[model samples]
Target chain A: MRSFIKLASVALAGLFSAQSWALNIFACEPEWGSLAKELAPEATIYSATTAYQDPHYIEARPSLVAKARKADMLVCTGAEMEVGWLPVLLRQAGNPRIQADQPGHLMAAEQVERLEVLQKVTRSMGDVHAGGNPHVHLDPHRLLQIAEVLRDRLMVVDAENSHHYRQRFVDFAARWALAIEQWEQQAAPLKGLQYVAYHKNFSYFAEWLGLQRLATLEPKPGVPPSAKHVQKLHNLLEGQSVLAVLTTAAQPTKNAERLARKLNSPAVVLPFSPGAEGAEDLYSLFQISIDRLLAAR
Target chain B: MKNISVWMAASAAVAFSSVADAQNRGRISSTEFNPAISLILDAGLAIYDNDEDYEIAGFPLGGEAGVAEEGFAINEIELVGSADVDDKFYGKITLGIHQDEGETELDIEEAFFQTTALPHGFTVKGGKFFSELGYLNVHHKHAWDFADAPLVYRALLGRQFNDTGLQARWIAPTETFLEVGAEWARGDAFPTGGSPQDGRGSAVLFAHIGGDIGASNSWQLGVSHLQADDVVTELGGHSHGGGDAPDNEFLGDVTISGVDFVYKWAPNGNAKQRNLKIQAEYFVREMDGEFEFEDAANAESGDGNIVADQTGWYVQAVYQFVPRWRVGLRYDQLDSDNQFSNVSFTGFGSADDLIEESGWADEDVKPARSTIMFDYSNSEFSRLRLQYSTEDSRHPGEEKDQQIFLQYVYSLGSHGAHRF
Candidate 1:
């Protein structure tokens, strides 16, 4: 009977050995999930929030907590973007390796230069991120910098895979640079094109493409657009030759549709991150966004 | 030479002012060290058939049991401050203010420090905080779907189990969500009464296990045990004969065990637009000891050896049918069985003699209630809710009381996410 028990225990341990060899990664958003996948293809990646969901607000399901508990590394966009949900998950997971100040914790925003950083913060400012806009992944230049930081983080957490991660980082950086140049050439016609947006979701993207954002549907950040605000956009469109009304996949399209109809312009829907319809990977995400914008124009 | 000196003076002033401007920018950029703070405001208007004196049947009024009057009232105002104390610990403080008996009172709801760097997947917390006994005890009131506490929670734990205590918990290194914890409390809350002898009155042990069912559904199950010693409880009820206060005193130990289950479903693992959650908890309490009751009319005391057992359970289901709208329904029931024998009442009149003869009821009194709620939230920070409930406990001839409440909750600043 003792021999049978010993053999059974050995079989159980062998079954779990496969999982133990792979690095378990928990990414707070889809952008980080895609980056982690690119850097460590052998790792088991779990994305907490999808592309079609607002990353600002998400429910911390038990499964998410469970994932965080066993994660070897956690990659996320910090600077208060996940201030609402990530802290609770970390506390509940009780994993010492992935705590805030640990080597396994990597925040992308901290590694890049943030835009629209505010000096003083108050509720009257309407949910403004004090660390500036956390939408840094939309800019390919910032993504390169964040990629380097994430690669180093993975090396520190999983030393055995340092060479694999370093090689992946070098290869990804070279390809990303080449793709950025190609995108720049293709998007030359979109420069200085005036457009209206549902929110300030793609400030970095607009800044990179040199597109001019004339107005926003929401009069204030984090607030739904009112009729008066939409009407103001309509009045502005009457005088200016705007290209399109731009919106993200996660945002509701009611205001965009209404504004586009009033102006007879196409409402351009862009993928904010990876895992959208045609943007299943990081490379395809930018290609689909640019193609949609160009088709709308 | 004079022309060259004048040019150098102008350049020096320009450089000095530029340096001062850079210093100002540096001061404004240093906001990283401040703690995260948040404030939540909840107020509502209520209408009820009860005349501010009606109490839920089979519920102890030791805690805040009375509801607001038929008018506008401030439900609660919560202020929270949290930050990492160091590399090894994190601290949080929550202050709650609410209107009670026409007076506003402030309570230190939770002030605790927890370890962040404990090895072996362990966490240790100390200070005054809510105990993790049942699924709902660790959650704040604003997180509830309905505007009021569930009937079972009110009867069993007095809304929450806030105590100054020490807790140690462990998260198992499993793929599934598995955790076990234990707490030693001062027992200044309900089910244990106020501070007992030496102030050590309650010990709680709990465990939870959860996992996902495929990709869209997740579920969790938990069990908890609370052992309270030497509970001197004052039963707040009316006498059967003369309508006077019964003032029954109970001196014994109480043991409560509970099990809770929660199931959630979100299509494609995206709950931004739609989701459904069902949660239920069942608890059973047993007490054994002496029960002494005062006879008001004859001014005599009756003593008996009483053994009582009580059970209560609540089940609620909430569905987010659309992005910003949610509806929920909840039902709860409480039942009690009391057995008393060898009662002796000396120098007593008719009322005292009647109480001594028939002190125990053969059948248990079961009280049940149901509530329904609907709410609309424009964002994660604000919500408007409307709720209605029917008290189904018919106390012989009393008509059923119906309640209506319209509430609004808005939270500003930074707040942590709620537990599932």
Candidate 2:
């Protein structure tokens, strides 16, 4: 009987050890979910918002609260980018591990330099992010920096998989650098190309590629374009040498298409993040964006 | 030499301006550490066809449950402040200001602290707050889709139920959403009177379950129960606008049970462009009490033992068919059954007169109303709405009241995110 009891204790210990290695990660957006997948292949991941959904205006659905309650770590693009709903979810989840300032809370935008930081902020400026533009994932250099920090975070949260996370980081960094080099060379001819976009969603991308954005479709940040505003823009750029009107798949295409038709240019729709059309992963996301731009030019 | 001197002047001007810009980058402001504060202003122009006293037969109203004043007026102004007190707790306070009979009145709408780091999916809240009795009761008036309260809410809950209380909630660890919560309140508010039972006048229990139906739809269903003891209430003296009627005092116990359901649909979980929301709630209440009235001038008096059963319901649908524009429709109704015995009266009235004066006479009229509204939001902070409603809850001989309201709500300063 004693030998049987010892055998039972051994089995229980084995089960506990196996469970510790399987971490649960909750990513606020699909881009971070993809990155987490690359780092910890064995862990379970859940992305709260998909590519088609706007991260800024998502609801704190019950399913999201459940996911957050069980999450071992949370990865988000924070600088108040998710100010609308993330706070409610965190408070409802009642999980101390993923609260702000904890080891399990990782905000990717905070790990790198941010662009478009405002000097003065007010509601008159529309829904401007005070900290900066939180779309830092579009810049390949900033993404690499965030990846390194995420790897370290993962190590701290799950120390048993430190070696695995480190090795994956080295591999991802090397491959990403090579892809950045190739993209730069391919995009060299597109320097100083003037364009118009739906929003400031592509600021980091345009800065990295030396593209000039003449204006945006929105009259102000987060405000939908009015007919008067659209007509005014048309009159301003009627006969100028504009390359194309660029927009994301998530944005409505009617305004962009109308403006593009008026300007006699193509309305190019790019995959804004992972899980979009032809953007199944991070690599394909950048590849498809550059490819679409080159094709449009 | 002349061209070189001009170039040097342009460079110097540019450098000086750049330095000035740098100096303006991060100025420290005096209100940096202040809590997030916001002010909401609600004003409206109301036109009604009937200029008589508003009363629903067989149901006495309490709290701020009444028809809007005729003509243009400021309905309410709400000042709210909220912030995290520390790592362990969050606190918020709201003050409501409104006009009352040519006088300005102020009331504390809510003041509460909620725990932030409670373990095992449990959270505790203390102080004064809105009771989670139904779906719409927890929301403020500014967040409502329409300008006025539903008829059922006005008749049964006195527009809404709130009190000084402590609440605890637990979220289950399930794939779908499930939550159970309970509240204990001082119950000095309407529907429960005088903080009875040693300051534990009322207790409430509620449970909710919800989930997403694919990417385009989501739903929630809830059930709640509330019970109060030793309630002492007054009904129908000055509110009836009849100078001869004496005030009736009620001593009783009350029990209320309700069920609420809500369904929302947005294409691909994106509500910015288009969405539809439908919600409904049904409640039943039982009151066992004694009613007494005395006419001092005539030395007339009355006393009776009474038992009443009341039911009310409202169903509403709001559709956002385009960006920044929405339209809604709501229908609500109320019914009551009253039984009186051991009735006696002196000098000026009979048992029937006592019953009629108490506003508990069963006239075979079920109060009901239908309302429709259209609104436009310029941004998240400002909205303008136009609403029309027709109600027939008055005495049998009175004509139905037709009402039209043009309302505007504007918010200033920082505001917290809305809860679903």
Give the top-scoring candidate (lDDT). 2
Tens digits of per-residue lDDT for model 2 on B133-166?
8888888999899999888778778788898989
Model 2, runs deviating above 4 Å: A1-18, B1-33, B236-246, B294-301, B346-348
Instruction: Estimate how well candidate 1 is docked, as a DockQ score.
Output: 0.26
TM-score of chain B of 2: 0.90
Q: Per-candidate TM vs. native? A: 0.86, 0.91
What is the C-alpha local distance difference test score of each model?
0.78, 0.83
Top candidate on DockQ is: 1
- Model 1 over residues B158-178: C-alpha lDDT tens digits? 667788889999988787888
If you assessed candidate 2 against the hidden native complex, which CAPRI class would it receive?
incorrect
Which residue pairs collide, candidate 2? none
The superposed Cα distance between candidate 1 and the true structure at residue B111, in angstroms, equals 2.1
Report the C-alpha lDDT of model 2 over A28-101, residue by residue, as the tens digit: 99999999988887778999988877788788877788888878889998877787788879887877767774
Relative to the true structure, candidate 2 reaches a TM of: 0.91
